[model samples]
Target: MEPRCHSWTHWADEVVLMSDTTSRLLIEDARKALVRRLVSVCGQRDLIEAYVGWILGDKTKEFVDFEAAALASKLRISEPGRTYRDVAVLGFAEHLSPHLDTLYALRKGLDWMLGRRPFLPNREPDFEVDGIALLGMAVGILASGEWEKRKESEKWFIALLAETLRRSRFELWDRSLIYAAQLLITKESTAEREITPDLALALAAKGFISVKEDYERKALELIVNQPNYAEQQVDVVATRLAALNWLMRQVPTVLPNRAAPEDVINLLERVRDSLRRWCWEEKPRVRKAEAVPVKWEILNEYHVQDLLWVILAPIFPDLEDEENLPSLGHKHPRCDLGIPSLRLIIEVKFIYNGTSSEFSRIIEEVASDASLYLSNDSGYDKIIVFVWDNSRRIEQHGELRQGLKKLQGVREAIVVPRPGKMRA
Candidate 1:
């Protein structure tokens, strides 16, 4: 019996060893294949960069800049209002002598890959090369082509991302991929608008080219795991609050007279508008210092309240001097903004994502808080719910607006600044 047991154990160990060995062999095979593919592309690996450098004669300017400068020079040198044919002859790409055919092919491949085809100057290409050589060259050309088209607006997003990477502690590969994906998605959009993961996924659904998968996956991963950029700005917040407190104390008589409840509601709207504008700024303030700002994944309800109290309280007189009015009923309810004269309470909810479940949760919390504030009868008259949809998560907040309208004392359900439009 002992011998049989030992033999069975030995057999199991052998099986485990075989599995490990098989996995290692497979990994090695994949590594070898990747190496061979890379080797095949070695000859033309730097061709695009070299060609661009040669054409520009300066390493500082990007390919797009070179193209733009060349085109502008052609326009200057050409006869006034030349025909389309004459203009074509003066094109930047037309003047390039080295591998002109290859450059054209590169641009064509880029257009095809970027979903820019079926537009203008479309061409047919010979399927000449395979493996990494073709793909490697194609990738560089695509980047240059996309940049040429999107350089103006795309820089803001890139610079923003670069600044964020400099400020944060994200890994090297993670930051690089994140920056690349952001640049790609920004170029993909027709409006030249900011991008999110869901937008990237939607763009992918609309049929982007081969490399789209890599970028889409990276963008999605980034959205899911976007680092929490909101560091506690204790010193800054405290300083600002102290300044506000002092200013408020000095001008106690300047508090706006308590008017109808509608006035308070309007005040909340203004606050919401201010926050939305701040959120959409080219360099959204993630930290106290405005030097290196980032957008999204940072400001929370507390930050919103802090900002509101400081900004709104000064203008609106009826706003309570105290911060975070305590509710007598349940421990869960807290008033972020309170109006003593009108008995109005304003709650700000920051929208993070567009998921139905997330929206549902937000709705549930608002409803519960509304019930709590009204339940206490501690002079709280109306609850104005401000949903800060910075991410444009609440697309068509009609249903949400309607649902919030049904809640008791909920005067207005405002999705701040509405989506896509912000006051500059």
Candidate 2:
């Protein structure tokens, strides 16, 4: 036989054709019959039952009718009365009810769980909302193989489990253990998230292989084998920095101090040393009886900034390089390296072939850079100049250093060895 309320559209149209009083009476009667039939139906019924019950005067039997033992036996509840099974039922009803708003139902359901409302349905709920909500959340957990998405449900379940355990007082075969286990295993069909004592003990009993080492090995393989980029011109240093940062984040537990500035600098120095040791172009040898002068390969300020980025990323993920100085009511100067967290500013200067003009210009530039850095209200505590003397031409280095030190906010100036100098 065809279901009477199967075609809601036809029913709705027929209702509209009836007189107002007659239509209201018909709707009220149909709702009453639906609610009565719902109580009799068994084995995973729709959440629509709750919506219908609420609409048809939300009247239902109270827990007084249910003997805890009988209820436990019938529903296979391991520990009866230990959990707010009614809340789970309501949440399920809300989730599945087309007529009920999801969030509204959730709020109402949570209110019952939190004891804000002393009772749900003004008595015994038509269905266990809490159980069904947990079951549904378990389905999500199993499908995603993650615990975070079901965080709200998990939190409630843990609290419920805790309360049940407390009431049972850790007794063997108690309702608390049974209820908690049932909730955990509710919808876990494949046993993917099963936390049984046997399984835990079995895992602990076995000798486990180091999976992390294998994962790292594969990662290293990819890093070494893969080209920097498949297409277009990509900066090699930038690519290397990105790969290194990814490795750090992926295995943060293995790293000494993840995201610490000094730790980042240490990592950077390792890369810098490797690059200086192997990546630089070597000078050509002169033939016998031939006089040929060889100039050292010099790296510009921008290239040096890229090298700084390799070390800075682990500590200061937000560290800015070549950032434009804030317009502090003067000509806007650009920073070579600026660590906002440390309030530290670094200016990099490289003198090529050390001519008198070049020497004078770079010295003046460092002094001006210090002046600009100090004048700005960027709240920088220290400014340091790193000068790479490629030509080794500066005589009386102490006097030149003193001149730079005289500038306001200027800290100690240091001359760094070039890659070519290190090669020698």
Candidate 3:
């Protein structure tokens, strides 16, 4: 029989069609019809029986009734209740009923097992939705439209599985709840973005993650998929951080703080440090000082501060009387090598074409406020500059080129180009 859902405008086609149509008709009668059509009629019996009790009685949920267990037993094993419930479900599927609870349960049960949790043996005799079928069903259930019963079922399952998997490898969530979560991951809409960094950081405090290390790792993975899952990510990572931080505080179980590999940290830092260059170069250099020898003389960026001072001393050869000028010194904060009066700070940056804006921001922040990089501007005659690899900057508007820009207070600025390495 064709599914009623196909003809019915507002129902799952398979659901409405796989119903148990046995009242005026007999199971024998329906079987013959299906066999003639070459349909296996698999699981149709249970499907039809489940919804039949209600469909015959005004389509209300009140149809979920049961006779006395003692009386039901004498009538034969096909009587109502869980024992012969499978038959009704199969019948419903065969006739293509708009109702389907057995399928939902089967999908949920399979999900619990898939998460590698300890589960009570599903006593139901197996049919189509088993193993691979279960996984496939889970994906469908998750991706399906709004389902209230599904959510409620998932919550109960999660709570139950928590107890079941408490002593198992699936301890992250209750064994019962694993299906619920899988449903969420699978069924949740991709368009509704809610992930964020603050959320990811907070998951450590919430106890969802036992170790900060594990939390960070998983958070990154989750972010790749859900960049905007602000709330859940925070709650999850916060839990992990809380657990990991607690473990760290205990003197005996002490592990190194943030055990992420140094190489990884260095690589990440280099990437971030690279962004500073991008922020600039997109905008024309607004001059705050005279355009001195724009290029700084540097053998390499290793001793960038030393190289900046070396380049500047010749450009602005010191006046004999002005011993109170900002001098070059490695200990100074801003110049990183310049003295009080002779301030000359320079960062060895590898500026890329795409990253000029980012670099501009970093350099601007450092340069805009002299106090930030240089302490006393007694004779702060020069502004610090950092140019990495590429110095050929093209800044223009229409057919006009804005003249070289300058920073206030500083007499001139120099650009130190790092050699060899090139950016595409």
Query: lDDT per residue, candidate 1, 1-424, as tens digits?
Result: 0111111122221111212566445434433332232222222313232323222222214222434433442443334443222122222233232223233333333333333122133543211111112222222332233235334323433444344434444333323234334444344442222233333332222122122333333332332232331331221112122222222222224444425567656766676445455544566455665466434333466655666677656655546533332222224245678664345677888766667886788789988777666642234668778776656754558888898888888988877633354422
lDDT of 2 by residue, 36-140 (tens): 343442232232233222212112232111222222322322233433444443333332222332333333334334442322446753223232233433322
Give the TM-score of each candidate.
0.34, 0.32, 0.20
lDDT, candidate 3, 1-424, per-residue tens = 1111211133222221112463213323432332222222112323222333212222212222212211222232233343323332332221122233233333333333334333447843232212212222333333222344446534543454334324333222222123323333333322112222223233222211122343343432332233232333222322232222332222111222322222222322343245333322323365666533232333334544353344444433221111222212212122333322123323333334425564555446545445433332222334433433344443311111111124443432333233323332
- State the C-alpha lDDT per candidate: 0.41, 0.40, 0.30
* Local lDDT at 170 for model 1: 35
Q: Using lDDT as the measure, what is the rank order of every candidate, best first?
A: 1, 2, 3
| Two-way TM-score contest, 1 vs 2, winner | 1
Error of 2 at 189 (Å): 63
RMSD of each: 24.8, 27.1, 29.1
Residue 405, model 2: Cα distance from true site in angstroms: 2.7
- 2 versus 3: better TM-score goes to: 2
Could you say which candidate leads in lDDT? 1
For lDDT, candidate 2 versus 3, the one ahead is: 2
